[model samples]
Structures are given as C-alpha cells and as structure tokens.
Target: MSNQHQLRASVLASYGATALEIEELLAYNQNIFDRSFSTLPTKFPLPPEPHVAAWEEYATLAQEIGVFQALSSKLVQLQFPILEGISQTQVYRFATRKGVSADDMVEATGLILQQPEQLQLILHQSFVGVIPVLLASNREDFVSLVQALTMRNEPKPVPDSMGAYMVTGFNNWDRVRQYRQQWSAKNFGNCSESSWLEEFGRLILQKHLYQDRLIILSDGFYSNVSASDIGLSEVEWRRISLTIRLEHECTHYFTQRLFGSMRNNLLDELIADYRGIVAAIGHYRADWFLRFLGLESFPDYREGGRLQNYRGQPPLSENAFKILQALVKSAAENLERFDAQYGQELRTLNSQPIMLIALTYLTLEELACSEAHSYIQKILDQLRTSLKEAEEHLKSKP
Candidate 1:
C-alpha cells in the first residue's frame, strides 16, 4: 500500500525479471547466504603433489616479468595486474582443468590470433596471488588476505563482440544512442552469449576458491572497459579515472569484500554507484550512471537500473529489492533530510579524507544489510537523533 511497494511491483513488471514471492525471496537469500558464507562441504581441489602448491612464487613476479606497470594521476595512482604469458600461469592451468581451453580464454578475451601470453590479465593483486595457488590446489589459510592490484594502463582496442563501449552519451551523443538502440534490439531479440563468460571466464574459477587463510577470490568487478583483445588508450583510461568509474570500480572492491563477489546484487551495485558518485562528485546523480548502463532512456530509469542490477543476481528478497529501490529513491529525493542529519556528519568527516573513506564503506555495509523497512526507518531516525547528540556534544566540548 506504500510507494515503496508500488515501485517494486512496477520495476519488476518492466524487466519481467522472475522474482520469487516474499517468502520465496527470503528463503533464497537464506539458502545462498548459508551456501556462500558457511564453510565449504569439500576441500578445494589442488594440483597434484610434486607440483608444490606454490610450485612458484611471484611477489615481485610482476615487477620481475615486466608485463604491467602502475600509473599515477592527480587523483589516484592506480595499479592493475596484467600477465603476458597466460600459458605459463596457473590461470591457464585452472581454466584448462575447468574444461575451458587457453584458446577459449583467448577467444573470450577478444585477443584471438594473439597468443595467450600476449593477452593481459588486467586484475588486482588479490586475484594475482590466489589464482595460481587455487589452480594448483594450494588455497588454504586460517586468516585471509585479499589484495587486488590494478594493472598498468595500456591503450588497446577492444573487440567488437564485448557488447557496449564505455564512452558516454555526454561525450558522444549520437554513437551512444545508436549503441543503446543496438543493445535494446539485441537484449530483446536474442540470447546474451557468454562471451562475457569467456571474456571474464576467470570468474567461473573464482566461484570455487574460498577458504580461511590466504583464501583468494574476486568479490566482483565488471569494469566497463575492454573485455576483448582491444587495449585502452590514454583517452579511454582518462575517462575511467576522471569520471565516476574509478570510484565505481573501487566501490565494487569494497562491496565485494562486504557482500562476497557476485553480480546482480542490486543493493551492492546501487550502493557502490551511489557512494562512488556521491563521494567523488559531492552529490547524487543517477542520470550519469543510468546512462552508462544504457538504461537512461527507461521511463523509470533510476528504479529500473536498480531492478536490472537486482535481476543480475537478486541479492535481496523480491519485496526487499523493491523496498531498497524506494528507500534510496526517497533518500535522493529528500536530500535535505539526509544532508542535515548523516550528510553533515559525513561532510565533517570528509574534511579528513581517510576517515570519510572508512565511513563510506562501513555505511554502505550497514545500509546493505538493513533490509526491513522498519529497520531502514530506524537507521534514518538514528541519523536524525544524532543531530541532537552532535549539538549537545559540541556545546559540551567547552
């Protein structure tokens, strides 16, 4: 009977994304959480002995091999992981074990005709270390360290098969429009091919490799960059950095760690994009992100994007997803309230950047888990109550 419920029903109808009933979605969330969060039923398979779990170690391997380098700009000094010789690494070994050939991977990368060694591994260090370890059956530790490394920036043209390009309507209006049209035609008419599966085939491998210490895995990263053989140019790389993307991807790092790596956790995507947009640009603008996703044209685009991301993997219950969309929509629409309460404290914290960063990730974590509508109201109420506490505390600071 509330606006939130109405929005959820409308958004679901728009996408035709199959959502379970309230009870069903609740059960699904429970089942998935237990499956993913709990200890695995079986030990992760490792490479046979004689091939020591770390038959090799590459702490300075990237530096020694010289495939990827780190780049610095005014804002962020970004580092990525790129490996030239896929045939030699555990990545290829594990892909092969999973029945995906190196050739298949190369094809997926859109770097076909290029040797596996020639294609790059564009990942973070966390992925860099554990990938090979898991391939050889060595990912086990009581404590875990997930360190992701961004690779050096290299300008290479992406393949035609990777779906849409990352260029925006703001920059190239006509082409972007055409690209969106083509996408609509495609999503409407055909089945989406798993070039993404091959393009990002490593994720299939990532799904299985979690343990206590030294557990290596990627929570999530769908960088709107080259998924194929084409490399990124300085111009494109600049777009990624200066725009909302760097924050966007960084948000994935935070949320993936918080929620575990999976796509379509709409809350994860929305919160990531929201925090990324707000933290970087200093206000919330759903239009830019919605446009980026090609969902800008949707009549209910903001709510629609949230729905689509939910459909990506459906992290919350059906009603819960709807509630989330409404909650965020209400927050954005009622910015004065948020700003007066939590926003002021956040602004004060942002004066010192590191504190702001920590709070941003933690706030997102709290918001993601507060699914009940009443719980959401309670959080907002607390934010409002914090105002009085701040005023009293400040007056008492003498």
Candidate 2:
C-alpha cells in the first residue's frame, strides 16, 4: 500500500478511528473516503513501546489529526477529537546531544533535579525551541507568543504547560548510551568524506503530539569532527549534534514564520541550514556550509551532517543548477551580511521583513515579477541581473 494509504490505515487502526465514524464525519465533504476504508481492525495490535518507535504511529496520527483539527476545529470546536493521552498545553522537548558530556549532563540534570526554580527561569529565558514553531504554524495551532517575546519581566510561568524529553536520559548513563546507540543505528549518514554520524544529534522537527501542542524529537551521534572547525574541544558532546542541529531546526521555525509554510523548497532548506550554522557558531563559514551539505570530503573523517547521502548526479536541471549556483553565491556573500542585516532582524522584524520576503520569492520564482510581491521581485531582480550577466559572460567565452 502507498505510504499515504498505509498512514491513513495505521492512524485509524491505532487510534480506534473506525472507518464508519470517519465516513460519517467526512460524508458531507466526500464519500469516496468513506467508502474506501481499509478492512483493518479498529484497534492496532501491541501496546506502545518504550522506544521512540512507539510514538511514531502516534506522531503520524497526531499530525494528521492536527491538520484536520486546524482546518475544522474552530468551526466544530465541540466535536473536535482528541488523541489518547496528548496534553492540551504546548510541549517542547529538549534532548541531550549524542556526545553530551557528563558536564552537560550535570548542568541539565542539576537544573531539572537540583534547581527546579532556576531551571524554570532558564527555560523561560530560552523561550524553548518549540514556541516559534507554533507561531509559524500554518495550521494555527498555537496562541500568540508576541506578548511573551515583548515582555521583559519573568513572564507568567508556563508551569506544567511545557514539557521536555532529554534524548539521552541521565538516570542510567551506560544504559542510556546503549539505548541511544541502538536508536541511532537506524540514523546512518555522512558529513563530508570523513565525518561519520555514528550517533544522532539535533532537533528534527516541531510536530503536533496533542491538541494545540508540540513535541520535538532528537537523537545523539558520534562523529569524528575536529574540535577546531566548530571551535570546540575533543569532548564537547554538544558539538556532536546539540547546538548546530537545534539551531538549524530553529531556523526552520524562523523561515516558516517569515514565509507562509515550509514546503518542498530547496531554497528554504539551504537558507535554514545556513542560518542555523551561523546561529550555532557566531559567523557563517563556507567550509562549514559545505561540510553541512556533505559537499566536502576527507578520508580521515566520518561525514556527519547528513542523515541520508544521495549518490550520482543531483536531481536538478541545468537551468535550476544555475539558479541554485547563483543563490549559493549570493548566500556566500550574504554570510558576511548575516550579522549586520539578517541575523538581528530575524529575531525581531518590525521594519525589515525583506530578508525573509526575499527568500520566499526565491523559492516561488516561477511567479512572474508582476504576480510576485514587489519586495520579492526586488530581491529576485538583483539575482536575475547577476545570473543574466553570468549567462552572457559564459556565452561570450572563447
């Protein structure tokens, strides 16, 4: 069965969403869906497992249900359905990096276990990574955080409203490490030629786990990375995956907020990753960009940034490649401008939405300048001129 079909079947079977009920609910919209219900039982076999695998099915179900909820919950609030155990408040998970050292362990655990008040204070300060996702959600899942960002005083405590999951639980260090390793066994990939992602690290996505809530997932990884490259020591587990990966996902939040939603857009991916690298390390470096893209290679290292590596030619047309090259060049130059124009504005953008508006246009370049937002056209205009000049230059080549 198709993944979509399987996913539909899985969600319903697992969640007790019997086909009859769905058919009744959706009959007004379309009957085909009602008639094509899978013959699977109403309940899926097996209880949820301790591993993330247990949550996988639920994740799909939640996301799908969340989408439906987003579209119809307001109109049908009283009739809106709920997941089995997901909470109503927003949940943001923070996980240990694959290389999380004992020091980080102590810091996180100390805050959580030893100093509850301080931990609450810090989390409040950090604003948690998941908040942005809600604000940027196209599904309109979260409440406004604009007030939270603007207020300086200790904002009203979220109390038990927010939740977190440390990727590597600290209770049993060895057992946690073993479980993490086993978990990452499925998350294999390369970071250049040398860096091997043996352990998983980084926040993957901001997903819906329950009603009007979010859940962040992470894994730890062991990679042979130079401490000097990202400017860390030999044992900084945060280097392995925590800092860079989390920052990247945060960028996804940023992009989603700026543009509408993050779809299958290559420009969005590159821009997000680029901004993420900058957030983690203070400045944008081309080598870091290349390494993150798995475009660089060295024999001694294990390619670490990639989760899955594609071989052979990239799936891009020549024209598309040219456009991408121009964007990459623009991106390289903009790296220096990151701190000046883009970075600060990214955090707080009242006057200048150009940085993001420009990116939105770049992805939707198929739109005529007339059809596109003026600011987007203005952004793409410069790139178009540059690309045209390069094109003419290539044609004039001897």
Candidate 3:
C-alpha cells in the first residue's frame, strides 16, 4: 500500500478497526449520500420556523443512520493533524475563580446536560451550513469553504483569559506545571500537544469532579456571552481572550472537552467567527459613542487598539492577521487615515484601529467574489471614489 493509505490505516487502527472496516464505513457513507441527494427536498426549515419535511428527512437521516456518527468519528480523528500543528504550550488554562480536578467530570457533564438545548442549536447551525455541501451537485467549492471555515480561528478567550493562560504560564512556571499535571491526570490518553478541545475536556472533567460552577467560565469567540445568562440552571461559560493565554493552554482546554463531541468544525468556527465579528464591531462602535460623549479613553493604536479601548477584550490575532493580509497597502493606508480623522472619538469608543481597515478589506473580498471582471472593476472604482471623497474631507480639516 502507498504511504498515504498506510497512514490512514494507522490512524484507523486506534479505533480497533481494520482497513476493510474503514472502507466499509466509507462505502456506507457514499451509499447514504447517493440516496439522500437522489431526491432533493424542495424546502428547508430555518430556525424559529417549524421543521419542514425536507428538514425532518435530512435531520432524521443524518442523526439516525450512521452518517453523523461516521462523520463525527472521522472529524475527531482529523483533529489530530490540525491540533498537532498548534503549539500545546500556547493554549488553554484553568480559571482562577474556580480550579478543577479529575473528580469533577460528573458535575461538568451535568452542566452540559442542563444546557443541552444550546448544544443542539449549535449542531443544527452546523448541519444547516454543511449539509448543503454534502448534498450539493457540484460540491468542490462548498467543500473548500468548509475547510477554510473549519481552520478559521473562531474561539480563544477574552483578553483576561489569555493573560491567565499564556502570560501567566510564562510568569508562573510552578502553577503552569501543576495545571498541566492536573490536565494530564484528568484526561490521560486523550490530551495532546495541540488539542485545545482535549484540554477543555479536562477542565470540564475537573469542574464536574469538584462540583464547581465556574469551571465553564471562559467564553469562546463563537459563544453568546450576553444572553448566556438566560438559562435558568445557572451555567456560566465565560469569554476568555487568546492574547493573555499561554501557548498550549487554551488548545488543550478546548480539544478534549468540547471538540470531541462536535461533528462539524467548519460550522463551529463560522458561528464563532460570526459572533466574534459582531461582538468586536459592537464593542468598537460603543467605544466610539463613548468617546463622543467624552466618557472613555481611546484604544491602543499600535497593538490593534484592543488594549486602549476594549481593555480586556481583543480580536483574535488570527482573524486580525487574515484581515491584514487581504488588504492592499493603499486601501489599508486610507483606513488608517479615516481612523485618525476621528481619532478622539475612535479612541474614546475603544475601537481597534484595525477594524475599519479590516472591514474595507472585507468589502474588497466581497467584490472579488464576482466572476465578471467588469463588475469587480466597477466595485473597485466605487471604493476608490469613496476614499477620494474621504481624503477631500480630511484635507479640508483645519
């Protein structure tokens, strides 16, 4: 067999399955897919709407047949490659307010049980977005998007979480070692160098063992930090930022704990990214409003303005990096000028200096999606014209 096939067989071995078994699973999946797409449903039920026939049929097949199970199993296995690439010394950490231990699995499971509805909703969203790809007549583009979305940096903590995980690890070696030891003790074989979910799973196990409510305090980028309180059972999943976390701390935290059960990494990251963008924008705008009212200080301009305005919250560096990469220098320069023009207000509002820049770049990406070159050129012209107007506005300033 080729090396590639050997590798696949090796990975499958962990599940106590032979190569033939894996192939059988693959064949089964293909058959299901063939059947599923053979008769495409006319309608799909979106959220808040009653489940339509199409929705029920798809959902039933996905959940009941071994499709979801097989996909989920493979996703977990594929996570090894992705997680292995990340530095373990860089992610996850135990929360300060409440530390966890191996004995806490029972309690942690209860918290998850109590919030089963939320978890289900997360699954539904993932299914909605990904099923189209699985069901698509021409699925190459959809598959590519799914891959991109899966790899996107959608989680990570608020600034404080980062400080606790990464920065603190650098400063507090003893505690860090203890934390890692505790993680290992709790997770054992499941913990990995780059698996944030595994570390997160360990935390959950520890939290439950200790019967602590604060175990799930850190909020991922995808989570809803505000409406999180609406649940009566009193479950707290706090938002933690990546900046302050140690290299591997958060990765380990997320991998074993939360990631293990999640079948769709692509949708998971998209939901998180969407939520992160909304929160960052909201926070940026709020800071702007606050500055207009002379109520707050400006955000830090050099360090992405996160420190200056948001204080404890920062955009995921990965997303920031992508935004920076997508922009042309001229477009980026114009955004800098725009931010500076409203410096006092922008600073007051806690806006990241990069946000406006990122948004403009995103607009450029949206423009690029068109197959018509003329359409793209027109969009570029409009952007240039808008920038020129902004420049004129700036020039007229005293």
Candidate 4:
C-alpha cells in the first residue's frame, strides 16, 4: 500500500477500532457504493446519474442508526469541528475573534469538559472516522466557506431571519482550472498548492455576490513545508479553521440582508486565530498540547506594528523542527498523567478519544514554537483558564 494509505489507516487505528457490528454494516454498504460508483465511466462530466436513491439509503441508514451517528461524532472530535460546540453568544465573538471575553472563555471552557461522556459516545461508534469521509464527500463546508468571501459586509442592521445562499461551484476538474487562474503568477505547484488553491478559489468564487467574507477550514497536507513560505503556520492553521467556520455561519445568519462585510485582514486574521484557540481548548484542551510542543506562540509584535518571529527564520525553521520533537516527547509524558487520572473512565466512555487526537495537534504545534517560550506560556495560561471554566460548567449540569 502507498504511504498515504498507511497514514490514513494509522490515523484510524489510533482511535481504536470501531465496533464490530458497525464495521460489518459500513463494509457491506461500502461495497454497494463502490460497485455503483465504479460502473460509471471514469470520464469528465460525471453524467446525470440517479444515484441519489442509493445515496439516500446509505445516508439514512447511518443517521437512523448508532454507527453513523457515532462516526459523525468522532469526525467532529478528530477534525475539531471548529463550529460545532461553540455557544451562540460566542458564535459571533469567536467568529470575529472577539465574541468572548476572558471571563466568558473561562466559563465556556468548563462547559466543554463537563459534557456527559455519553454525549461524546455518539462521536466514537461504528465508523469512527465517518465525519472525515463525509467532509471529503460533501466538501460542503469547504465550498461554502470559499463562497462567503465574495460579499462585503454592510453596516446596517442584519435581521435575525436573514438567510444567505452559499453554494460550492466546482468539485472536480473545473475546480482545478479556476484555481490555476487565481494564482497564475505564483509558483504553488510544489506543495499541493495547486490543488488547494483550486478548491479554495472555487469556494470563494461561488460567492460572486459578496466580497468581504472569510472562511476557516483545514487543507490536506502533502509535504512538510514550513509556515514562512505561506502566511500560515501549524498553529495558525487551527485558528484559520475556526475563522472559516465563523464566516460560514455568519453568512447564513446575515443571509440576503443589506449588511456590508467586515474588512481589516490583519485584525480579521488575529481574531480568528485567537478565537480558534479558545474554542479548541474548550473542546479538546488542545492549547496545552501546543504549549508543550513549544510551537504554540504567534510572532511577537515587532517594529512597524507587524508580527514577526523573534528568530527571523523562514516557515518551519530549524527551531520549529526541534520544537516538534520536544512536543512529541512531552505529549507521551502527559498521556501517562491522563492515563493515571481518567484512563479508566475513558475506556468506559466508549467514545472516540477526541481528547488524545486534538491534544496531539496542539502539542505538536506548541513544540514547533518552542523558541517563543514566554509567549507560548502566556497564551496557554489564557487558554487553560478558559478551558477550566468551560469544563466546570459542563460538569455542573449532571
């Protein structure tokens, strides 16, 4: 098998195998899907096939039963479904990256941890990685986010019922063409940049009516390129994911009203990153992992009011590599702590171990930023406090 195949399987295995019954059901259904999807000629313009009926059978079966529901739940955990568990008040604050104050973040944090394990069980059932598969298939979230960028935010009152229509335009080869057009002058081909840009453009263009919107989501990684090349880093990726989710829901919230879009890319990005971290910590205590990894801090405010790393290095600098290694080590140490405390409960919960997965990314990112030790600590302090409150709230409920 290819390296990519192995990696994907490794990720699945890490979450612990799905229930035997769920594996059987999905396997059979998958066979049916493969047989149906395969018979179609491997050519463009995937002809108008009436496979919706078959698809509906698969979809309905998953939803009405435990396996699919569990799979969906687990996907949210692994991907850190940035938009799923945030509170409504936080929706805008988090989206704008200012919806929640420090106090609010603290309270929200407790609630997240306190949520009943039974609820999380829904995420770890039959096909543990169901959400990722769905994300790949629908591409809806990604597509919708790109479409949101076309509109400008107006400065008028957006009615509570105003709804926007955000659609994804291209999903295949056509998508490739549009992406190439957007970054024609640059060289992005080296890092799966071509494909990523293509999909991003299609999503953005879908929102031809608007011009001041943003989207947050993760892109598939092809290589180990550092963040200096692009204007994003490992830590920034998590934040970006949160920002896109906010823009997506905001588009829907302000659907069809005369609301001008918000500008200020720097502020916009900063807010997204900050908000993403806060929300992620609440659900997964991921910020702690970032802290341990030493890759958790953003560039310090430099001369000219811009953010720059103290090291003056390019993306994924040598320091970043060292940080990553340290993070892995630290995480192993912490897992022992976790096992000592909540390990048994974890086994009984029977839910997807989202905590471990989310923590992994956080720790890795933190390690990557180890050079900025002081800055990393500050952010972690804030993140941990917020998470504690969110957890407290969750526990209080039951």
Candidate 4 deviant stretches above 4 angstroms = 1-315, 348-398
Question: What 10-residue stretch in candidate 2 is worst by lDDT?
Answer: 116-125
Which residue ranges in model 1 land beyond 4 Å of their true spot? 1-61, 68-243, 256-263, 292-309, 312-341, 347-398
TM-score for all predictions?
0.37, 0.33, 0.20, 0.21
Q: Could you give the C-alpha RMSD of every candidate to the true structure, in order shown?
A: 18.8, 24.6, 23.7, 26.4
TM-score of 3: 0.20
- Give candidate 2's whole-model lDDT: 0.33
lDDT string, candidate 1, 1-398, tens digits: 25544444444344343454433333322212111212211111212221112213222343455322211110011111223444345544443233333333332242111122221222222211222211101111100111111111122233211111111011111222233445557667542455433433443343222111221222111233221312446554334333344344444443333334434444445545655556555665555444434344543444322244344343565555554444444333333233334454454432222221222322221232323234444544454455456556667886
Report lDDT (CA) for all predictions. Answer: 0.33, 0.33, 0.28, 0.29
* Candidate 4 steric clashes: 52
- Residue 30 lDDT in candidate 1: 26
For model 4, residues 349-371, the per-residue Cα lDDT tens digits are: 22212222122122222222223
After TM-score superposition, the amount by which residue 284's alpha carbon in candidate 4 deviates from its true location, in angstroms, is 16
Give one digit per residue, the lDDT tens place, for model 2 in 113-177. 11111111011102112231221221111111211121111123321211111121112222344
Model 3 misplaced stretches (Cα beyond 4 Å)? 1-62, 65-285, 288-296, 299-398
- Model 3 misses residue 319 by how many Å? 22
Q: How far is 198's C-alpha from truth in model 1 (Å)?
A: 34
